[model samples]
Target chain A: MPVFGFYKLYLSSDRKYVKKLKNLLGFIPGNLSLYRMAFRHKSIATNVKKGVKNSNERLEFLGDAVLGSVVAEVLFKLYPYKDEGFLTELRSKIVSRVNLNALARKMGFEQLIEYDNRMVSNTRQGSLLGDAFEALIGAVYLDKGYEFTKDFLINHIIKSHIDIHKLEQTETNFKSKLIEWCQRHGKDVSFDLVENQEGESNKLFSVHAIIDGEVMGLGKEFSKKNAEKLSAEKACEALGI
Target chain B: MPVFGFYKLYLSSDRKYVKKLKNLLGFIPGNLSLYRMAFRHKSIATNVKKGVKNSNERLEFLGDAVLGSVVAEVLFKLYPYKDEGFLTELRSKIVSRVNLNALARKMGFEQLIEYDNRMVSNTRQGSLLGDAFEALIGAVYLDKGYEFTKDFLINHIIKSHIDIHKLEQTETNFKSKLIEWCQRHGKDVSFDLVENQEGESNKLFSVHAIIDGEVMGLGKEFSKKNAEKLSAEKACEALGI
Candidate 1:
């Protein structure tokens, strides 16, 4: 703590909230209202002006962009030889809602989110936490500024919580990942066996990832499962998931 | 020009390119190769290493994120009373490919972009200009850092070229815009006139914007054209375009 931090914390009305935020983010917030608003879900928010609520939705939009830019920069520098398709996929893996929800849960975001449980479903509640996580980044960006938010995201969040190296090495679940991506985007994905060539080995299997009724990717391998996996991987690359 | 800039320009092999870039962007680039890569279309690029080439795609991806973040921040502050949906729509309008293409043309991006005309059709060439615009932003970002790039975007680009207030007030021709958006996404969008209400205004019409066979937005207005426009606008809002 700074020399005057304890004195200010003792007198502040929302000292507990400030302390918790400080403890979590490793920085004192400039605008406390932004931080509060970051956790205030639409379920509990009152309309502020012109039908715009003092909810975290706006913050989520801003934070999403901020997070995307930071992640893009990180991936761009980390993988100097990789193409945009690879960088985009790795960034998506890092910022996907499922990954974010897990990160939020691990970071105790549950304590800060202010959504009405009755209005939000049990399944939707997890997203509320992820929403708040993005909103928190928005709050930090607005409160401190872009450079500060970048530092916080890099030093405090990405460096400590994320493993970019490990993420790159783990390419085993492309089929499931592609399916989940399709589900999230309200699209349908299916793997279909393509007809084998007349002269090809009988043991070799051919598969295609049919997403939204279009063949997004094709793969041929010895095993059916491997073919499916390879096709899904190719689909992910094509879809930039 | 700054001190020694004229001297350096005299000795530089690509002094004309440097001068052209400076004239367009209102700043001298620090890293010249990054700027060169920004304009190098994949159609003209040779292999650099692995599958990656000296193309603009990676930089475009990075610049896309950077531009989104900068635009998000700008809109967030500009429209304090607006919802995220509104901000998102406005941001898309500014960053849309059509807008960027027009902007790039106005700024003489055609002269800078290096592409094989035989390989790229006339229709495809416009998007290449837009891609180079984005990649140029990425070059600026990499050369001058985020703060400097942000300042360049805001001061040199957005402030001088864009009219936010005018864009907000001018909400005409949304139907065509929506159709263009759908075409860009390879989705089908149709405006169907639903049944008119009995005993309502004689000219009243009801329309729904059906996207991918799903009713995304509905609107009721005095005229069929107005109804279609309103529905399209609502669909744009719904799609966050």
Candidate 2:
């Protein structure tokens, strides 16, 4: 670093904080307070005015949109011929709370986030990192600009960490999702082998996904497992679950 | 337009369309095909390939994200001290299907949209204009880029049209509005007091809006009246009332 720049960094009381953020985000935040507010959980934030607190919630809202737009643009270019349904589904998978929570963990966001440990439960604690990850994006957006933020998200976040093709595989895992959905709705669901077409190597297995004694979907595939999965996918589509 | 630009417009096969778009949007389109696709509804669209149609749906999806990001930034700046919930509510009002439909009608979008009149119902027909409006934004984003689109949205769509303060005024008396909606739908509605957080102030009132025996919204405030109003507003927003 230049002598003057280092001197400025050295003289600041928040030198450690700025350095830590720079090390983590690969950019020195221009407005330090934005970054500070991004990591602060509401539990530890005192009421500022008009029932508003200096919490990361507002930043999360902003960052969510920024991240979504970036991801949407990337997917739109990457899958030019794909339909809206495909784009929407892929976008949701990439931005789901569960997926983001995992990303935050992998990116070491837990080290930066400030939350009251006693107030937040174990499950709620998991979301704190995800919220902070989004808030960080918001901070970057404000400190820089939309173009810079887009570049940062595309180069630093999406290209560096996410495996899009691998993530797409999760889209086809309909059977487990169907089971989970059924469990949530308190409905009994079952997949039963309906028939087999042909007898030799060209044989196709048929399965039916039934819920509450009614057949929700029927599918035919080369293997029993795949037939069940396809049936479950059809059922999921029918139920919009 | 300059003489050369006029010559290009006059000689083009879609001169009328190009002229109409230029008049309506206040700028000439760089990519005419994108604008055409933006107004093409799915009911009239031929399947391109693999269940994909050259309709406005994909563009609408892209535009939704772009519009959301722009609005979020605007709200973030305009209401620096506002909470996420307030920002979210205001943003939704600005981008709601009902609002967009009205805007489209006022801005002469109905003539541009191409839908199979026989296929779309009355309510669906109303939203078609809104869909096209978003798709048009998507076209602008793709053709002129994000900065241009943002400028266009702020200057032409938002500032020239919407009254933000007036909209905020309309957000009042949501409790009465929610009750009216419930009554019209023949559903039972009530505001119930939920337990205040254990560590929170004793004066805090947490209210839940219950509709048809299901919890629809929760809101916290210092007074029960405000809490109930907030809860009802949340429920109304949730129901898209």
> In DockQ terms, which candidate is top?
1
Q: What is the interface RMSD of each candidate, in Å?
A: 13.0, 14.2
Q: Give residue B104's lDDT in candidate 2 (0 to 100).
A: 93
Model 1 whole-model lDDT (C-alpha atoms): 0.85
Per model, how many backbone clashes are there? 0, 0
Tens-digit lDDT track for model 2 on B1-241?
4566556666657798898998999998877789999999999998888788999999999998999999999999899888999999999888987688889999999889999989987636878988899998889999998899999999999898888778866765789989987887799999998775323467889888989887788778999999999999899778766
TM-score of chain A of each: 0.71, 0.69
Residue A80 alpha-carbon offset, candidate 1, angstroms = 0.8
After superposition on all C-alphas, the RMSD of every candidate to the true structure, in Å, is: 9.7, 10.8
